[model samples]
Target: MSSPPEQHSGQGKTSDRASSGKMAPNATNAVSFFNSTAFDTRVNALINEWHVPGLSLTLVHQQELHSKAFGFATLEPPRNCTPDTLFDIASASKSTTAGAVALLVDDEENYPHVQWDTTMSKLLPDDFVMAGDSYTNNVTVEDVLSHRSGLPSHDDFYFSKRSSHPDDPRTVTRNLRNLPISVPIRTKEQYNNSLYTVASYLVEKLSNKSFEEFLHERIWKPLGMSSTNLQPDKTREVGLGDRMSKPYIWKEESRRFQVLEYEQTPEAQGAGSVWTSSKDYALWVKAIMNKEAPINDEIYKGLTRPRIFSNPEDDDLDPFCSWQGYAAGLESYFYRGHQIIQHDGLISGFSSVHFFFPEFKVGGVFLGNSENAGTVGSGILVKEIIDEILEIPESDRTDWNARQHKQNDEYEESKKESQEKLRKELSANDDGLAEPLKLPLDVYVGEYWNIGYKEMVVQIKDERLYIDASDRTMAFALDLEHISNNTYFLGTIYDMLADGEEVDKIKVEFRFDANNRPVRMGIDQEASLDGQLILYDRVEESSGQGQQKVVVR
Candidate 1:
């Protein structure tokens, strides 16, 4: 459980602590923190070695602050991580709802079927229940937060496709309501979006208001968190979109975080969709510590409980992802005598991480515009800071390199497995059925250019259709359906279609005539052009016809 906030006597402490976080420790008493002398140097080294962009950390020990800002928020702009920089804290948002519901339960009657007993039927829209399954009939609110809901991480039905159903605004929650259950409820652990998707409804059901409206009036306004919010309207924008850290993703080959657009607009309440900065989020961390205020102990425990036990796949994307220490809302990792309560957030390009140790009352928050900055690496950095603060041993600290190595190995294996699948699909002629591209080798060769993208040259090298286009070089086996003469569908994100059926494969519209003559064409539709960013015919197709004299007839 989170510790109650102590009352500050204003006893010769730093003035900055009072304004930043009532619980912030005095900077003058930095010596009181573990090995205060070598702290800053260690923190800097970690960021530099990791190739992190901008990061902000605030460590509170006995009503004092040990906070630092490092690197640039944007490399070219030379924007730095300041005390006020905001970040998109992704899944870390699970805890906020956990905390909010816990606080509401304190004043209101306990919600109906809120615990594990309350199945998805009671919480989600009627259609969400699967046609043939009964086990999925009992997923609860707590189960959702804990990720124990036996739902598949992704359903082929929702495979990157958004439903245009008009009953509700398109959201992950509504999607869950319509999805088939992948596994039985509570039988095995799968990080289900359906659970948290339902949690948004529960928040609305119990709070007597929409989650956005409810949080704005109840939790946010009360806490004086002037900046934190869900939707940012640039017209009326203030702290919501202002002073925001530009989100970036690390380019492994380029060795830097590349700036990208923030695309998530959450109509649902929870499920890691909210946005806020380190400056405003520090208020939230302080609120979690202050049990005497609106945030109480009941809320703290709810937010920190172990929501799931064993996972068939322990290293899946979500928290509760690991078997050792993950719960509904917070991840539980052990460090010597202390069990850390933590959460991390990821949305589009922005990332945020929050960590609190209930033991020493030493907790910190990290926010970065760059997704690369706040992944497993962010967790290690926090533990490192905690070790430095509390004088904890290296044994208690996280091994960043080891953890990174494991993550890399897993990613590479997954990638190779994916590649193999793609290799097989291209050679097939049936729906998921096996057939190779029926065209002759030379027929597939040409400089293929469509409306928007740069030229993609098709060459037959090693008896394969080698495609070279904007920053990405791809090779497909010569086995693909001969669509007309030049156009062929290249399967999903990582594979090529085998079964002759479209099966929702991306339409690789070839810019060629029936006779296979090359022609420049235009592609206008909602496609995720880059970084999973949904561009609504967003980017203009490059014009190869630029400056050509029209001389129209």
Candidate 2:
């Protein structure tokens, strides 16, 4: 649980131990409106209830700044969170990516020919094809950055816990031609991580530096973000790792948050992968909020300007909000007669939200160290702070905290119920089929290949069949359970098709030739361009050389 907030008086640099609920003005243009007792109690309760290990918050109104840290950065060793504690900000780093791109666009010396409207074909590798529709040939940088690139949300194609090619964005980018376009180019919004990875590569191409180096030399150093770094290597080099908050995932079986081992995967490069502190991030917020010189003024303007009409579905959470629209990196909506621009990000075990009112000059940064804390806990915290800053009527501030908490509870309960049903179904049907194995386990052991997804290997080990599906990012070995005849089921794994809704087991089948020898195998997984089952043919030997052929069904 979070300790009480250590209050600092506005006038002097001394700490105040008084339990007075009052407002005071600082010597500068800032003031503290939060009643310390009430604020501390509410935030601590939220953290404990949501199972968040730690969080850091920063609020900027006019020139006044307020920062608060709570709970333990890591529950194991037990380190209290401070303003300088680091957390993975996740996709909130998108704004930074967009900002860097916009800054490069405005720079004439380095990239004189590049612009937001520049065709992606001209900027990317000449061999990079958009496949299928001819309209895709006209796609530009703006289309991808604004989520209007007509691509579906196929994160599995590039990122997962088991990806073998972690550092190669080109592995996914080169395969984009094999995936079908979901919508007309620039017609609708569809969130895609593939395009962002491609965009980050483009930055490397244009700047002649690695994406991490570009961010460090150009943005981080300029803004004096000492506590921020793009990759774990730099973070460790600077000794910031000791102060970093370890990521945690809520395990339903354990009924508690468990520490997830962190991996420096390249798949998160362009879309997420930023680790920094709330205090350090507040510098970024202040720069954008004030619209400072060098890079902030122009980059902030370009990023905040609406490029698409997309709006978050949760706009009703604030009754006073008007229409919401998405910009390149930020989203804009009217709230209580003021234009509010914000964005939220979620990674494996961390979440963050950043927003600032351009007109009102009020901005807030929220970081949480749990899966539920970022979306649920940060949402409530930000709304309450906004209300306090605006001084909304007591009755007008509907109990949004309770409503969001209830939603979180419902989501968890629903997942538990679904998993229970799947467990029972799998347990009831674990017997050998009537028809038996078609051609023995040896016939099914071979390397399967796909153009989009590289390879999956099936092998028999310890008298049982198991599949090494690392190519699809399913890192662990899947044990094949006999169902009926040639068919077997991969039990318990969640489906990416239904957004983790359905746990319907995956079915695998082996096909045999006229001579009763295995020719190919099929699996009920989406790996084809047309969203069909993937097929892998036998690896035939050609002149003492082994070659595997990909067959899409």
Task: Report the C-alpha lDDT of model 1 over 184-237, residue by residue, as the tens digit.
Answer: 555556654435645766677666787777777767788777777764442126
10 residues in a row with least lDDT, candidate 1:
1-10
TM-score, per-candidate, Cα-based: 0.66, 0.80
- Provide the lDDT at 376 for model 1: 34
lDDT of 2 by residue, 385-423 (tens): 667667777887857777786676886787776645443
Residue-pair clashes, model 2: 0
Runs with alpha carbons beyond 4 Å of true place in candidate 2: 1-35, 133-136, 159-167, 296-298, 309-324, 409-445, 459-491, 494-543, 546-553
